[model samples]
Target: MKRSDGLKMKLVDTYTMERVVAGSASRYPKRIALRTYAEEGSELTYSELKRKSDAVSLYFLEQGFVKGDRIALIGESCPNWMLAYFGLTGIGLTAVPVLPEFSPKEILHILQDGGVKAVVVNARHVEKILPFIRKKPEFLIRLEDLFHIPMPISGELKDRNQFLNAPGRDITRRKVDAKARQLLSEHRPKEEDPASLIYTSGTTGMSKAVMLTHRNLVWNADISSDVYFKVKPGYKALSILPVSHVYEFTIGQVLALLCGCEIVYLGRPPAPSSLLPALKEVRPHIIMTVPLLIEKIYRSSVLPTLKANPKLQRYLRFGITRRFIFRIIGRKLIVTMGGRVRFFGIGGAPLDREVEAFLAEAKFPYALGYGLTETSPLISGGKPKNHTVGVIGKIVEHLEVRLEEKDPATGIGEIAVKGPSVMQGYWNNPALNEEAFTPDGFFKTGDLGFIDKKGRLAIKGRTKTMILGSGGENIYPELIEAVINNQDFVTESLVIPEGGALVALIKLDIEAFAEKMALSVNEAKSEAARYLNKLREEVNKELNVFSRLSKVHLQEDAFERTPTQKIKRFLYLRKKDESSDA
Candidate 1:
């Protein structure tokens, strides 16, 4: 397929991570493949990446680890994380990447459920795994230095620190010689072999391990980089989202590798203090993120700055003038984002309405993607030029997508898909596997959406979160929350059913509220209550009667969210009789 740059991407002989890395190495041996953002001398070329990954594979084999064994990777995004992932998956091991943000209990559940035999952990996250080290895993390799972390007292597991500490061939400095390469080649996984086992974030309180095969991941990365986005060889990609999530792993890391683009990892959270400087240093050509990041930027910086300008406020009242003003602001935004970004990909959750409008009118290179981990996370998306405000764009190439049980009036229904990228099934859960797919083989996405007249997909909300109104009408909390979130002083919101009526829980922008009211936090809290009640009345006028909130409550804390910034609805689904207060 011809990519956006008009270059033809040759079909891979085998759909596997090994093939992807090997191909890039052979094609661009001296090209920088991975590096830490703003850290000089930390770069790895394509050939170097391949050799290091090979060394990692041989190191695992030398430790008595074998293919098909689940190896857990717990860490922030970094070059070492990619090396460990490629090393394990290339040698036919199932890569079980645990989110570093997961609690100790949650991490334990994943390690136990996946039957992880080995763990490649970041030093910072080792405390979370220390208690469970005796339960299942027999090996611990520190990710920071790529050395064996010695554990004592139990003495039940082999101590491989000696091998890593060896003078001639240390773990980090080891070279995969011909003999080691030959041994590693013997374990090359087939296309259908499970490459990674990813656990869902559990917005509904039900987490399951999703088994994605080599073909599932490779094919998605192949088609996505080749047919959908415009990323060129030698282009720089700045990755911000957690690589543990399929949305970033497939599109950001793997696809960039497939395209021979240099990937710069933040190696830390992308906070303004660090990320702003990294942007200037990297000057990346591509960036992938979730909606929360951009939405926060819009709410905290761009929107406030624009609203505070009295001149732009009057200009923003007219459609043409608003777009023109946004265009100028977008140019500044591009410069702030390193002055060289070609594609700004957004997914993991729906983009807010106001943010999407600003991006669209400003002609920002912001793209929207929609899918679940079950599909290798890319069902529909497009370049910015083809994007509509609310729609997620056209279905991806070679995928069959249909709306199941469509509503004649609204045209919304469950999104069902069949494609090469669809997952094999949930790990060790046959019942869930059966229920996750249609009888004919399509994966039931469980997301409610409709294809617009332009053939673009517009997601409504999760079917699981849809509340049935008194008159049996479907009230989508996300849609209502989107509207509420667009209002001033509102940072985020959730709509839930209580006492047979809809209740709105809002998290206010404390600083903004304080500044606006010119009061201390304690005083602001009381004012916030009055403001929320007024906000609810105003927001209700824009919503349908059945969807209107019966009561507005101040949520003192931010709602507990999944990694994707989606609220864990199951946690707040129950009714509460407590009075509304900050």
Candidate 2:
């Protein structure tokens, strides 16, 4: 198949997960394939990665694990996590990646629901799974001990190094290595065979496991590598998002390996302190992040400076001057971001219009993508050169998409898609599977949006999140929240329906507001109330009548969010009765 770059690429249908790694290993054997940032970081060449994965897979095979056996992998993003994933899926085992951020109950539910037979977990989360180990899986293996351990049977061998050096270990490793070679030479996974089961973060409700085959994931990666960005050999990518999410797994890890990019996994959270150093050290070529990360940077760094300087603010009103000023600032931002970034890909949520505008004005090479885990996550996206602010550039190559139940006035409706990259269905849930697809086989996205004349997809909101006004008008809270979030002193806001009126729960920058108003803590709270009322009047004037917020309430605490940093609307929805006054 030909990629958008005019490169002739092998179709995913012709290969399996094992072949994907083997092909890359042959091509970039000595190249640094993966790196992990810890107290002392580690690096692995493509050949070493393949060898370590083979050794891990050998242990699993020796322990009686077979093709189709489901194994759960739970940990933060790291080299071992990827190695375990490749080790499992490379041999046809179905890997279930559970987010480390999930609660213990949530983790238990996934383990039970997926019917996981064995688990590969990090030491930190081992305690959370220990209670359920006797009841759920057959055995557990620690990721840190993956290299030293001989077999993964529970209570079998306590000494890892001793076991590795033992004569029995040598026999098992030799046998497993031979079997691995034989399988690679003689057997390969079918395109239809299940590869991984990814559970959604469930921002709204209970999470469902989405089953993706080797073809579903590999095809998405191959197509994206061709069309999304230029793939330069030795390109460096700093993976900040959780690898458990399909968005990061396929694009950040798998696609990067396919394109021969060296991936550096941040051992710590992507907070400014940790991220800044990694950026300087790695000097990455690409960064795959969610909108929240970039938005925070803009809010804390750019917005404050622009707001304080009247001269710069006036210059921003003129396009020519704005570009010149922003270019200088953008260059500094790029330096702090490790200097050589060609692609700043944002997904997992909508980018704030103001933040995106700043990026466009600065000429930052930023791209936006829209998708759900069901589609293996890339429904629409494009290169920065072709990007249009506020639009998810265009439908990706080889996918068929359409709108259902379109509203005549707005042309907005549920998005439905059909493509090889789309998942088979929600695992073990026939009812959900039935509802997830149209009779014609298009997967129902449950997201509301309209395609522009130029083929750009501008999302309106989620079907489940749209608020019904008192007069029966449709209100998109996200649109109203965007306006509120852009206001001065407002950090974040959530618009919800309360007693048939739109009430906003806002988290204000109390410290900043107090300093700006020259008020004490108690006086600041009172002043904030008055400011919110006045701000409400101003915001309502900009929004449509039906979408206007009736009241703005202050939230002392931040709104609870999902692993992906999406506000858990369902949690706040039920707590409307407990609404506090501003």
Candidate 3:
């Protein structure tokens, strides 16, 4: 409850955080905790999780590993992801989570850069770090063993036998650094003590290690759960999203533990083929996903239905019985997501306005949020603005938000915040860390947003993505895209300033345009040029002075994306050979 700068902090009491969560087994011993991705398969429970955690704590003691020693948790999102982190935290250890998508070189960079001693990883992800074993033999430890609390009957290689047999240099050499580990065992990490170091994805620069204290992470889980999820006793979460990413990492792992929620993690991908079956079975109450997945449902399934029969769309939109049937289908979707999917959260990237509108009209409670990893990722999120539409929710309590350095006319600027959830600093990089915080201690979020008179915040774009105009004006490309995406047939749009004027690179709904033109699916797409000119005229008529696209550039391919599915605009910006005339 105490703070260094004398500012009062909203602390999630650790004892309370774990009380029900750790005792889930006794309370809901028969309830399912986690189910693998496979259909109708293995199920774990609260009691099982706690016992496994104890075994993990015992395993550390047996191995002579200490509290603060950094354990590389290399995997995406899964049941074991939660166990490794909480078991480490519960026993006073710090967890270092490595992303599954990292290339071999990048994985090596994280292991060597973090000075990690042991690793608890998915047997699948071990391959990514194999080449680095010879490079850092002393620090190597298998990530596969971190799944179960007790060693699985010894010599136990369910998925790891392949590694033992591979012809690589022996990794078990030299003494493991025991200082951090020892600190964990001797003294519990205080609220202010650093608990983990997350390396940023190097899309911007060399990945900087973010130093987050025990309080920093816990505080994020506490508030995010209360405001966004209202997480309560026996809450069930479908934990399939990659835990290496902050959004899933917190909800899929920390939030569940802090709220006594049952975490059902599938150690597999959530592609449509596998996801629907799991949903039909677990019937989880909570589901978290990015805009990409939701957008696909709209494009592939939802749109096709509306396209096949225009009357159906109109009938569903207006008729009472049809609306009831639609609600039933939505309810089934929610139930398949774990039965209580009251809150379907979409974050990490902006939601397309058309997709959001469809959900809103359909009466689906698909709430949206805005944030980056810099703020332990949860910033503002809630039900969409009905009257205004597309506004991000009000700022959560415990965090102070204000726009810093802006143009008043546009009412936009980079969002800056100060809160307990903010990280300690970037590890071992004081220069970058210093740049990250303002002179007054506010953390620079690099995101752009403006508050309405009624107090809701709407994110416009990232500060770095702002296009420098011929004059001094700042133009947000995403803002321009938002307007374009509102059009019914517009699938996705990206605004890239070319030759000092704003240009829109867009992908339209070919089938819809084809139907509008009375053409076959193939013919509709083949004659997309006619539709482009028509859509261009419509979009141009709709845009404001600063927001209007000077021209339109239609792209055949969707887009280049980061691992998290965010568009890599820099690639397009840096390419001199792009269709500049568009």
C-alpha TM-scores of all predictions:
0.94, 0.93, 0.82
lDDT values for all models: 0.85, 0.82, 0.67
**Against the true structure, what is every candidate's RMSD?**
3.8, 3.7, 5.7
In TM-score terms, candidate 1 sits at 0.94
Ranking by lDDT: 1, 2, 3
Choose the strongest candidate by TM-score: 1
lDDT of 3 by residue, 274-326 (tens): 78877777677677888988888777777667668867767766668565656
Please give the lDDT score for candidate 1. Answer: 0.85
lDDT of 1 by residue, 430-504 (tens): 999999999999999989999987788899998899999999999999999999998998999988888789988
Models sorted by TM-score, best on top:
1, 2, 3
Pairs in clash, predicted candidate 2: none
**lDDT by residue for model 2 (1-582), tens:** 665534345534243677667778888999988888653547888988878777666666657777888999988888878888888877678999999988888898888888898888776676667556645434666676453322333434334343333232221133345656776444346767888999897668768899999888887888788686787879999999989999999888888998888999988889888999999999999999998998998988898998999999898899999989987888888899899999999999889999988888788888888888899889999676645777888897778899999999999999999988899999989999999999999999989999999887889899899987778788899999999999998999998888788899888989889999898877888888889999999999899888888888988898888777889998888777665542
Residue 3 lDDT (model 1): 48
Which 10 consecutive residues of model 3 have the lowest summed lDDT?
167-176
lDDT, candidate 3, at 486: 66
